[model samples]
Target: MGKARANTIVANTIVPIAGEDEGDSRLPSRLRKWGSEAHLSSAVARLEALLADRGFERMPWLAVAMLAGIGIWFALPGPGEWLIALGLCGLPAGLALIAMRGDDRALLRNAAVAVPLMIAAGIVLIWARSALIGTEPVAGPRVAVVEALVLEREEQPARDRVRLIVATRDPLDARPIRARLNVPEEMDDPRLTAGAQFRAKLRLIPPQRAAVPGGYDFARAAWFDGLAASGSLLEQPAITREGGGIAGWRSRLAEHVREQVGRFSGTASAAIAATLITGDRGAIPDSDGQAMRDAGLAHMLSISGLHVGAIVAIAWLVVVRVGALFPWLALRVRLPLAAAGTGALAGIAYTLLTGAALPTVRACLAALLVVGALALGRQALSLRLIALAAMGVMLFWPEAVIGPSFQLSFAAVIAIVAFHNSRFVAWLRGKRGEGRGEGRLERLLHAGLLLFLTGLVVEAALTPLVLFHFQRSGVYGSLANVIAIPLMTGLTLPVLIGGLVFDAVGWGAPFWWAGAKSLDLIIALAHGTSSLPGAVLQLPQIALWAVLACVAGGLWLALWSGRLRLWGLAPLAIGLPALFLARPADLLIEQSGRNAALLAPDGRLYLLRNSTSFSAEAMVEAMGKGAQYGVEPFAEFPEWPGARCNGVFCQFEAEGRVLLVAQRPAEVPYGAMVAACARADIVIASRRLPADCQPAMLKADSSLLARRGGLAVDLSNGTTRAVRPQGDRHGW
Candidate 1:
């Protein structure tokens, strides 16, 4: 018999002891019968108790890891050295993991072992990069060659300019970084596309950062895009063909697929197919994407765990069913192994299609873990296995740990696995068909039920992350998932397979129109379902305590059972009220180049500027958030109602309604109508402010909130005192 059959035998033999409910809380199977193992388990339990006594837990360790990530962000080389140093940082953590194999592994603090190793790896990566890269260039004049690889020459909404990533090469430079240059100029937009490359003799200087108050540090964005320096098109002297290694092949394939779809279908259909296949939604209009986001079907668009798992599952099923029909093939290679291999292939193909983005990398890691386990005949997968997989991948690619996709993907998976294992250990218990064969619908029903429960568990699990990163809640998300997920699994998966198959064959293939029509219908379903007005729940910018409460509550629910769930509600119950009470601003002055938005304390959201500008829309969206929670809004008070006025303010409606604005008028006579001047409510400056803009609050009773880039000033509760967001001397 093959390993799958052998495992099935062991699994069945073990299942008689493990899967069914004895209605007993503490019962051991074959592992428990190992009396010698008792000592080890007890020692591990004692160590866990000690850790509990010391107030150590996973969440705090998570915070520590993030702070370390922040440090890494500041410490790493300008751009080029990041890749080389990144792999080295996991050395310490990877080394520490080896100790878990010992008999007394339970006694040692895993975090103490792991975190040091992790930090050491980080330090090594950081030090090596910074030292070798030698002296990062600053934003100043430098004689350099501009090598630009145009990644995607697409027009941005509202702006006529085309955004392009010019691949730069600097051999003589201290640090060699391949970066994307953002040329926001519109006149030179239409000519460039994906495979285009340009070279120029231009002064490329390091990116700029916020030197003073109310400036959008262009350098920060440039840094995120790996663009270490910036310069305009000084002189386009030459044109060279550039290749993107793996990414180049993937981009070319993506373009080919997109063109194939477009020639056969409309632009929207092609765009949708490209988004699903290549993970490039830059071509998709913002309005369409935003509508999708509003509808809770946004996850379907992202190439995360769900998408990968869907592909794997479908591939595995097809391979298994087909292999079973081929008696000779099945006899030679076991069906389960064939299915697993097929799943692996699908997972890898999905990763390649998505340009191998970090999130997809993590997803592939996770999918590979499960598929590997199946091939290895690991019948009983545990939380330890899942955690080990996550840690292994993260340590291997530690930089991914800080990305939102990494955190949320692992978070959801961890929560679901934890919940499923805890509750369903004896899942086959107290059932009528415990020993009987189950039908397809019965299995489907069970799987659907599990998915529903997991969705709820995962959402609660990821609440902290969602709030911190996205600044919103998906109250309707579970409901949305319960309805849309089934469609995605059943309809969407089949359509993608059909499309892929059709692509491989000629245009005469019958699957082409069928797949395209199926895809079109799925799109229609999502559009119709997501059009519901109350499909999403938006929340406010909340305090750290609320976030802590949410995490604490999640831990309780995940780790504890029965009545403990009720206890978990306490943090959330209290946290919600606190969030409502802590409305940070009375009036929000959202600055746009065209018009500003004013959100009053009572929650009236109005725009000062009516012009259609990026800044204006951004401000309106923000102020509209204040309106969501019934913040009192004072009526329209645009200083430039008819004229182009530069400022907007709110003042003593009756006596003490504090006015907020970007600029403080030099001549406002009323002392009672005190302006938020030196103590600004909010500041938006076209030019950077001087270092000395930091000033004490001039308050009779109102408070002050002032910030100058990194420098900050904040007065508390009508007190003339100030506090920084971070407790440092430079806070005020």
Candidate 2:
């Protein structure tokens, strides 16, 4: 009897009695003890225990997996036609699997089966989006007289680019096509503004593909944006008609703000103000833009989550307070619902004013979802809410999945939401009231500390994305954000919002001036921080596979809720080393074949000409150089041992291989060219190569470049492997 009683007692302790607490029942004895000892509150402990319960519900994880699958689908080369057939089959198969298996694991099995279906759906969406854009007309560069209505006009660094919706092509019944027209700086006319219709000769061609491998494909981006062609205006466009409606109002507003700000302040300051108020970034100098990016203040210029959230919050608070003044109204209307509606309206209005750019559209969608959730008495901030927002955005703008803005914005928000909901944060917030009654100074310090912590969290969350996409990480981003974000949010943005409101009644001059003053301070802060040593850390180019792997691991860590989520660390560990191990191309050539660059042994990019600064900057950044190297002009080439240049051509040795960039094929002596090629491993000829001058060396001519776009040579091993931006022209 005694032995049996002891055995029973041991069994009872090992397991749990009926109707016991789920936390104590589900968790191991060690975990329960740790939770108790760690001062975890009962509610937090229960929440965590619930999250850890694998059988509780795993729908959110399944949803996240589907999203990942979709992202992976788009990242691949092209949408496979067979994916549609697969999706059609998988949907029914998933249903059958769920129906046939009534076991506890049925849901998990079903979810696993559904992932490919989701990916297939994504593939279909890509195909649908592409089909929607339609085929481009095979038109060559020719002067065609067309009557075009300007949809938008932006000032480029050297020229003005205008987007026009064609009204009429004089001789041809051309479909209303969206064409990009470049106006030379000298030929820019004040009358050629958005909402104005003009009759002008346009020398246009179908959108061009990426010039080199791994280069940005403007043509692909244009296809998604409904741009049919790009061209130059033969002459200054004559304004034959004026704009009306919303477009006209926006154009007038941009023009008015530009003029007023320019009159009130210096050109640079005015440009800043215009950017803040009217979303006109055209006047901002490249140097200032680069400084802003380096200092991590670039987001402030763009209307993103920060701006959208502020507008909605302010509007909600105002509505709630005003409603509270009338108790009956507040009670009847419900302050939450009223405030949410007001906030949503404000967000929508702001989105429209900003032209509904991708980032702004995403913000608006997220704001609306949050506000709607609040109105519906649901949790307004959760991983589920973020997933919903992401899915909604991807459903409409699938192309955005590849863009940095979408990826970074969503990642930061998800990480923030997850962090706020973590056990550590919960414990910290609980400790807030544990101390003695704090003084005002203590309270302020606490607030500042919280602000700093938030900034740190956001900066860390975005660091990987910044490195992967921009190849430059902001070294002082946390400090910069702590200083600049508050000023922008608490002062500049508020004043700007109020100014826009007051401007309707022509009483916004003071507010605008105050906003401008705040902007000046923000700009100064960015410049100061950027001027610091090592403000930006340029990282070597990370391989696409590594980026994908990291993203997968991060998603696992963030989207799942359990101790098992720690498994994500495995992929992160593998991906980080891969980033360092990956090497960049040895040589880069522009699509035009007019300029090229070589990777120097001293970890610097040696440019053939300064005119290709855009490509050179990309190369330098990829090589982990924070600053661009000097371009060695042919006439003033450095008389180095491995490289030499003359008026006709430039040659350099990299990785024990010599490359010759021929500038003047016709002018260069044939024997000299042949001799140079005979001694070289690669020759990039800007002009046509003579048939008889062929050498054993690899030859890259205008014809090959035209077909390949841009060229990159990988001489990592003993052999030279060339890659093009457009990939194999004849391959799928």
Candidate 3:
């Protein structure tokens, strides 16, 4: 029965309001009043003014994405007519219109939106094109010539490896190389600074996509994170120092903090101190990182949006509390304004010190939005402000949209804002009054309930998409997060910050000790919680339709009413059953020494092939699943022999019964036995055995490839059917 006004749609969904909940009645009323023409026009006018004055600020990101896309497109070795049509004609023509033409502000204004959208789309197309560079599977020992700037540096606890970020200098088609050097504790290097360049000759591993369906595509994820490739240093990548700008001073300050912590305690403690101040944890051990990830406290290791928000808020409180001592000064300046300005300045310094990571930048951006609201002397923040912040983010770096960190950070803020506005309205009503028989504890409990509800709603909204894209989800997520969050917010982080100050003062041992203790406590809590059965859920890779259906269903359930929400589930209903329809089969039957479609009996993605017309592509697509179940065999074999030989009937027996055979050295007990052990209920095999074996079925693949192209034979019913195959070979 509720349909949010368009303005409500923009406001409630786009930004974080301070104290609101989703189901609150007051928000809709507020939005209805705010959605009036006056407010809409005012907001629109402000946006226009900003666009008119500071339009140039928006060009850097678009230019970079376009320049990057064009550079990548041109780097491709061979492009056909359509590629040429798209690149030379379509792309250049589109770019020429957007990039070159600035005849009028009106034209530029329109192009501003259109041009960037095109650039974003072009970047995606280029990525696909680059992956599909070669006709056959690309396999080669790659020797990369990299002239790379050090973007990041860190230590790996597993192999005692030190990793270096090297942004590629060449305008060629390639990945940015991040190389790790196996540095012994015995050796010392002169260069460890940012802006240092190197020509590294290395044996490169582009990225291993663990052939599991829907497993985390670490390689693809890394691409949007500005990582082109990862490799090991072949000959200690040739190093040359380049002068860093003012950032060098911050890096130097960070180095000082690290040294002081090291002098007082140890390197690990020093790393923790450095991370608090400069967002640098390069020296952290791999074991610690793994423990953190496994325990679901890994987010603490990185200077994420939450960490940044905490730092800003904590710093603001510290400043306000201290500033109150000087009453005369407080009279002249408002605490909120002073806090906002100071927080921004400190955040900038922190961002610079930390090497300006993507997560850090996003958090800083969110903080900047809050600061901007204060600066403008606005009592009530608008969602348009948030949307504009997003626009700014997208304008400068549209690629952020693809990254998980970006989505989660933005979504959390949106959720918080919605909750804030909704709850504030409720609090303002009679709901919070003592006259209504509510007490302080009751109110606190209600607030806690609201927070938990919001967190659950967000997790539910995010989970399906997360599972589909990442193939991993925290199962005991709420419990894990709840335990870790208090530790993160209270003891561990604050003491870590204090340790940084202590380091500067030359007496940080006590603070470092306390912080380390907090870490230990957190580790203990995490280890306990993570050991709870079902701490994580590993999901299968989903088809595109599943992705679409889930998204549609999520939006419908979140935003729509009863009937509409149910209809949204239509796509989900249609997709899940359909997925089982395309699963890979356990036993693929065909003639010897020829190619055939390896059918998935359960209709999961899979492919297998031999020397002939049977393309192993479907089997390849399904390889991810097959790999887990050991579906791929070096030779051929029957689907099932034990039951079939004794009692079952044959669907397509050549000599009468099912024959279990393997063309090469393979696992014992034949394919049927292995598959049956793996819980495959049915078996399909070759029709060349004796007549005794019953309940046995077979399909003559490839022998009828020409006559029955795109067919799946149902041996149980003696029926043949046509089905278009979905394979990565079509255009992976």
Candidate 4:
């Protein structure tokens, strides 16, 4: 019977080839001969079988195609009207093809036509979204007396600073604009709160661009967040109106939580408590934040999926237990439905209270979907649901497609779901179910193993993204998560929530103490694990294509089922090594051309300027050496190997090419400058050089740097790449 069924499956997958039609005279003889071959026919049949097996699982591919379109929109040099037009034209044709009803033979043909259309539609959607939210950035630095309403306020007690997001009328056009203002805490008025109108003397500047090539783009982020400018307050603000809104309430609640927690615990614990309750992370100390990042526990601090899920679960359990106590009320109203509704409400309320960050919003959406599934007696956790949630997020916030938060959160959940749904895991579950008489210790061991495996899979999924964005990832994250996750979800978070709730009744001290102690333990674990040798894996900057390849490979592995998914390993094998194998540029020139960094043969980075700045630190990070080999000022070691300086003209020789940097051209003789340029393959000067002083290969001066922005040069091949290419006019 098995052999017969297998034969039936094979027969079903086989489809007639075009070459099989003898009446088609246009067919090449070679193609007809190849189609007649049994092996070729078998290969086609196997591919068809794979597609057929995918069934509804193919839905996730639509999300992938949409994401590709969004990426293309961002990659274009300017507004992509041509691309949008093409997509819009193809939409109807693609829809017609998809709507055509056919047997298994037509599946591949339909997909080939529909996928590209979906990608085009994706591009169109993102372009429209960008246009809708587009706002002109602040033109330049200026000091003005601005009247604005505070939207949000963040207090940094350690730094004695307060940051405010304010909505104000633009002085140029009187259009509504949002500005981020930093004010000294001492200058801040006690009456200042969200919704309070105020007037202040402020110095505002256009948002900053990336300090180094391929580094974070604060300008782009600011653009998406609707921030027109950012600067510090020049004078204390005078409140024009009292605040009374949800934002005001949130600020007051956060402050209250912090004060109450601090009364029983240290300031660190209080800060964490405030963060957990209100998503106010400004209070977290830099040292504690760094430790959390190094130990890979940083996600715990973010009010994301784990936190939202816990809140929902706790709410559901509480409602169900309360319903059970009242048997008469439970009889008429379905307890599970009631519980699901209550849980969803809690998730939504918590999401709003935490400022509705993208991750939290996504989690809340997913939780709502899960509640709906439960109420409808459908599968609660599946790839289809995740795909739906992702599509929903991208529909509104298309820019998030490129963010690390969206990528990491979705990737981790997808990996977890995919891993647990594997046949091997299902088989293990079946085996465990059969052994229902197992001892309590055995059950605990099984649960622990499952947690460890889940953490391992999530860590593996997030590693590439972490490395791509931050240039570093924790090596012991999986093991740390195994211990930390349970402590957080089962004890600390619940206790913290309880403390906040009962504090109104003056009976929250014990809960606060317990929560603080748990936080202390988690913090200690982070520090201990982070202190271990090689706990963090520092990698060089990965190429954009390599990271995309890794993402594609991961999606392929997670979205598909069966032996065909093993093909994902091919790209993973190639992309993972590429992360470590990437080499830094031989020379880095800052955008202003006033400073630069040179990579020595010994792997040390030397900065041309004596002072370290953001550009210099970024260069060191790009070199993949962490803080162990901090950047050294060239003046400190001017006579070192492969380079020399005499306070005016510095010469560097790398990869058989000589480069000259003229720091003090006025001090040097004209003849010496010309002579140095003649011998050098590349010349860089603080000021524009005369035509006669041009180098053989390339020359970069203040004028050239101003036009091209920051540059990275590879002396080995004498190629230079600019951060901002000439003619670039992207909105961000």
Please report, in order, the local distance difference test score of every candidate based on alpha carbons. 0.54, 0.69, 0.51, 0.81
User: Tens-digit lDDT track for model 1 on 418-458?
Assistant: 67656463463325258358788887776667667777777
> Candidate 3, residue 550: CA error in Å?
3.1
- Ten-residue region with minimum lDDT total, candidate 4: 628-637
Q: Give the TM-score of candidate 2.
A: 0.84
lDDT of 2: 0.69
Q: For candidate 2, list the clashing residue pairs, or say none.
A: 211-709, 211-710, 212-710, 212-725, 213-724, 213-725
Candidate 4 matches the true fold with a TM-score of 0.88
Our tally of clashes for model 2 stands at 6
For model 3, residues 1-732, the per-residue Cα lDDT tens digits are 145577787667644562467666676767677679678667655655655664533333343345334433433333453255344435544654665444433434454555555554555555464454422211334565667676555543334555655556322445334433334333314364457777656655444332222333444445444444555655655667663655455566667666655654655556655666676676666545544554545567778766777777777887799889999979988887888888888777667667787778877887788777776787434444555565566545654554567656655554455445453446654455645787789876765565556556556556655555544455555555665676667666787677667767767677767766655566666667656776654444446566556555543343333243367677767754543343332333332313233333343432233432213433333332322233344332234223232222221222233322322212324455444323322233322322222333433323333222333333344444322122222221
Worst 10 residues of 3 by lDDT: 723-732
Index of the highest-TM-score prediction:
4
Candidate ranking under TM-score, highest first, comes to: 4, 2, 1, 3
What's the TM-score of each model vs. the native?
A: 0.68, 0.84, 0.57, 0.88
Task: Please estimate how well model 4 matches the true structure, expressed as its whole-model Cα lDDT.
Answer: 0.81
Question: What is the C-alpha local distance difference test score of candidate 1?
Answer: 0.54
